[model samples]
Target chain A: MRDELLELVMNKATGRASDEDLRRIDSILELEPHLWDDYNQWHQEIPALRGVICLAAATTEHQHQLPEQIRMKLRARMRTALSRSQPNYDRLMELVNTPPDPQLSWRWAVTPAVSLVAIVVISLVLFNNRPDAESAAQTEVANNQPSEATVSIAPVIQVALLDTVGVTRGADDSTRSQFQKAWPAVEVRQFNSSAEFRDWFIQWPAARGSVCKIFYNQGSGELKLIAKINGEEKAATFALKNDVSELSQIIQQAQARLVEWMQ
Target chain B: MNYPPIERLQSGDSEAWDIVFEWLWPKAIYISRQVLTPLAPSDAEDVVIEAFTSLFERIHKVYSTESLPSLLVAITRNHARSHLRKLSAIKRGYSKTIPMNIVLEEQLPSQEETPLESLATEELFDLLEQIRLELPERTARYIHEYYIEGLTRRDIAECYGVSVHTVSGNIRRGLRVLREKLKYKVICTDDLPFRMRNR
Candidate 1:
């Protein structure tokens, strides 16, 4: 509950936290795990919080208008979907278009039958006439899908961080917190020695499509990526001048490469 | 009593859709955007689009004229939920599951839906009115002015001889009270910036 912890948590949550910020957070949390519970509680509350805010809008009829481009985008997407000409949409719709006031009892009685027929009609459409229209629709969706990068859905990449042998091995992987801090959904494990790391690495089932990258710290700031993924061992190495200012830049480039490899 | 141009909407008239869009687009987007947090504004727009797409695909089935707005609201939220579910599933490597063909649960009959969800539009309005009555008069006034009357904080402040901050605080806190009373979660923590940015 410290202000610094809150700041760090928000920075990490909002994807603003640097690796150093993440490490500091890990170190802090390693010392005080209980603080995380309070933060996680608030974090878990967000979905429910979001649900209620929307529910408030629903009940109160909150007024809002999207920007023109967003409106246009949605409009295009809808037109494309309707253009597919989903079969029998008109038939079920005919049943549904009854006048609300006069048909209260009649509508209720028929709803079950209508839903049943609709389900059957939908099944037929999906199974019989669906593949081509759906594929075309999917192509349309992929083409029209928004490329705007948003961090709302956490990244799917699982990262493994390996450092030199001098770092002491502890009860938990120290690197775990660093990776967790770096990416919201990331799972991490660290081994202080090659013996310890290899023991775990040997157990990784290649059949499971597993992949691991070993970044070697060769002399003269040479960065090498040796990955054994799905039984394929591929190594890619590059050298950079190890000037202090450029060290950070080189490390960033190396990290970006590693990220792309993992993905 | 306000109805969309149903004939136009049914006939696939672009103008009908335009009319529907102008009428319900704001409310649909409002409901759609609220549930997507840490999500980009674009994702919320995508949810709105998905909801509209679903409605457009099934416009033939739109039975109740009055239920159209609420139905869109329901569909928008439903799509947002489906979107989040699909996202989590994809994270778990279930990318094979596609949501384009997902059925509209809110549109279909469901037995387990809460009474609140099943409430008619008039009933929901009446429920909100009752909840408003339970709120403190000042809180209710702030909410009414801010939402119903569409008054800006500065306008409300000037009218009530108070600072804009007070108006802002009251409106936000009043909304929280109303929201919590209705069993919803957080309001826009940042306030209605998209709407209130110019104001």
Candidate 2:
């Protein structure tokens, strides 16, 4: 929960944490049982987070278009697999030459329809359940759901403070009070040590399948909170001026959205 | 090109196969490139073909079209790992050996995958796309160019007509944003074994 300790952990992870820092971290680990959970969370998140950054970094490059030669090879391979004769090309030619459907053409047109059909057919083939596509659709539906429907998936508030904020009472006490004051009925747990934090997360109530994990990245001076709302992730970022009141306001807004969004 | 129903693939329909290839080839190649960067395009093609061949042979066993993408991805990953293992072996033969873990820095938690790990791969892929789309054009472009295109920090800075520090800062902020968004963990303390219990 200590920012200094976390800095040490990050350095240690990157092989830059000093022996002194490691000793301090070890001491923190012994005293603060719940710190492990936060550490573990950071551990799991960092690599994949960087991997994603690396992945997105790569996506900016050229699109991986299939080469003509490779396409030909794949086609030939397909033909061989299907035991089709060379003259079977007529099937493709005939299909192409066939008159376009007037209704289908007028309504959807060629490119959009083709792309749409390709997406559907490929999706049907590729995934057992198209969670990404379906979840996006569900989010759209969830976003526009009527007040009555919104009442069904009542949101629960669960918050994690990943780093210590130079506050008098520990970050946990302050964070809990902030939430308790806002929505007294919500279940709230404050994690100060690794074990407690990790345990709290591990024991997240089965009934409430979603949670909000909040942390302030001291290095970047940003306050970030992420919510898993019905399997879709929604996140908000605010520039931190090291003011708890400012963070509380941003968190309040996030809580309202979660109430509306959580299914 | 018009693609037939994927169901026909079960009966060895070449046309269906063609359509599936057309639709998934780019993705397969992209996945390969991501997993095995510095891979030549020809090698990427080979990896894709190898995976497709595996699918072709097991078409009958594929009970549903669902999971086909996951299946292809898994196969591609395995092939890429195999390539890495061989590369490691070759490098070992030549000089001081590097551990496979060092060689494959992004080693997955395969042996003891948590429930989160199992779902994280597919989910993260989508989350990354979402984050990219949500990011500013310049920041997103910087990320894509630096990570995807294998551009160095200096190159990206040069390309964007910005300082290297500026480019790095943008990327770092972007990564932090991504990290915050995707950090989903469930700590089931009660499930811990005796050794790890109450540690």
Candidate 3:
């Protein structure tokens, strides 16, 4: 009876035997009173065994074709066991179907590093160009005066020196020479008022970092000069009544040329 | 109609490959999610997809259909474990280690079980899990899905993008491990039939 019950139980549990096999085991149990303890033990173990069987059957069905009845029974038993023993199928399924977190991926891992490099590069570029940009603006303002009128009259000259001269050793000499040679060719546009000249100076690139304004009275030979270096302004009023030097006229012409070239 | 067997996949019958993929995708995804519970849904999918793509490159050796599930489950577990290793390796300021208990909780069903039943289930799961972790990521995933989650070998092969032969090899290797681990747990010789115990 124990052997028959064992055979029936193993067959039923492994899905190798049919429900009839289980019935056969039940019959053996019914017929033998002494084997009841063993039968009860088998019954106690059935749920876990059934779960394993169901899982195995589900897996085995992929390769070996099982009888439909056996397959159905396994499925039913598995469903019952899994549902009753572990009710978290829905939760597990939901987790399985849930999408993966993108933050953990490699793309996001390097974002901070990438951003830091970008910021540093941008800062270096801006820091290096700031003074060059200011010097260029200052040079532009110095050039915007009328050559005919300013060259003949001695004008009050006000110059503001920069703290540091960022001369790019050999690369900038040619540009400097070019500016010196063009000094004689300077011609400024005539304006009725100093405000007009100031407005035009504001638009000039050289005027961006530094600014200069000249007020000249042809009859009195009086010239008022106001120049700004960086943001600080210096004002000088000069009387050219007694001055007749060629150096003064040359200086005036150079200033006029610088303005014309900038315009 | 000529139904191409698993061995023919490596020779380059794309249609045969497709048929296999269609069968295994859900099971593979299911198994991957079970093993890699800490990963988000998208990450799990990516892991599964990557495993399948890797599997597809070598699908020539799978000779039998019975070994497919085991192969897929093995692959899935290996992939998830590899991901965990990678995560751990890069643990810096923002790294998080998912609790092992939580991972097991997520993977297992959430129902009350008798102590004996739970122990048996745990034993079987532990055996498979250990075997899966030891295999290559793709192979481990194949086994987990096929054996634990019950997906077919053909389906697993297709999903893993491999030929049936390769999938079968994975299954064979996985089953060998499982048999070794589970041998002592078989209390009674009569509890498993000849066919089930033979492997």
- Which candidate number maximizes lDDT? 2
Q: Candidate 2, residue A250: CA error in Å?
A: 73
Number of the top DockQ candidate: 1
Ranking by DockQ: 1, 2, 3
Question: Per-residue CA lDDT of candidate 2, range A1-263, in tens?
Answer: 45544445545665555689788888998999778876666664445444455444443433467677887776655554345332433432332234334464234334545776998888677655657988788768878875453456554456544321112132334555665666577554443222223334434345455665554332223444555555544555554444444657766666665555442
- Candidate 2 residue A40 Cα shift, in angstroms, is 4.5
lDDT (Cα, tens digit) per residue for candidate 2, span B8-99: 87666666666666666755677677666764333555656655654554455555553455455545555554444444433343233222
TM-score of 1: 0.34
What digit string (tens of lDDT, one per residue) describes model 3 on residues B98-188? 2222332222222344332333223444444444345555665565565445676698988978998888676556444443344335434
The DockQ of predicted model 1 stands at 0.09
User: Please, what's the RMSD in Å of model 1?
Assistant: 25.6
| Model 1 Cα lDDT, one tens digit per residue, B1-199 | 3555565676666666665676777777776666566453446765676577667765777654444665677667666654555444434533232211122222222244333443433444444454544555465555455554466668888888989888766655655554444443122234231111110
Candidate 2, after superposition: displacement of residue B3 in Å? 5.9
Tens-digit per-residue lDDT, A1-263, candidate 1 = 24455445544654556799788888887888887764564344333333333444453353565567866765665565555455434422332232224444344435555766998899678767667878787658768775333223322233444332223223454334433554445455543322233333334333444354433221123333445432444344444443223434544565675565444
Q: How many backbone clashes does candidate 2 have?
A: 25
Docking class of 1: incorrect
DockQ scores of all models, one per candidate: 0.09, 0.09, 0.05
lDDT of 1 at A255: 62
TM-score for each candidate, following the candidate numbering? 0.34, 0.33, 0.26
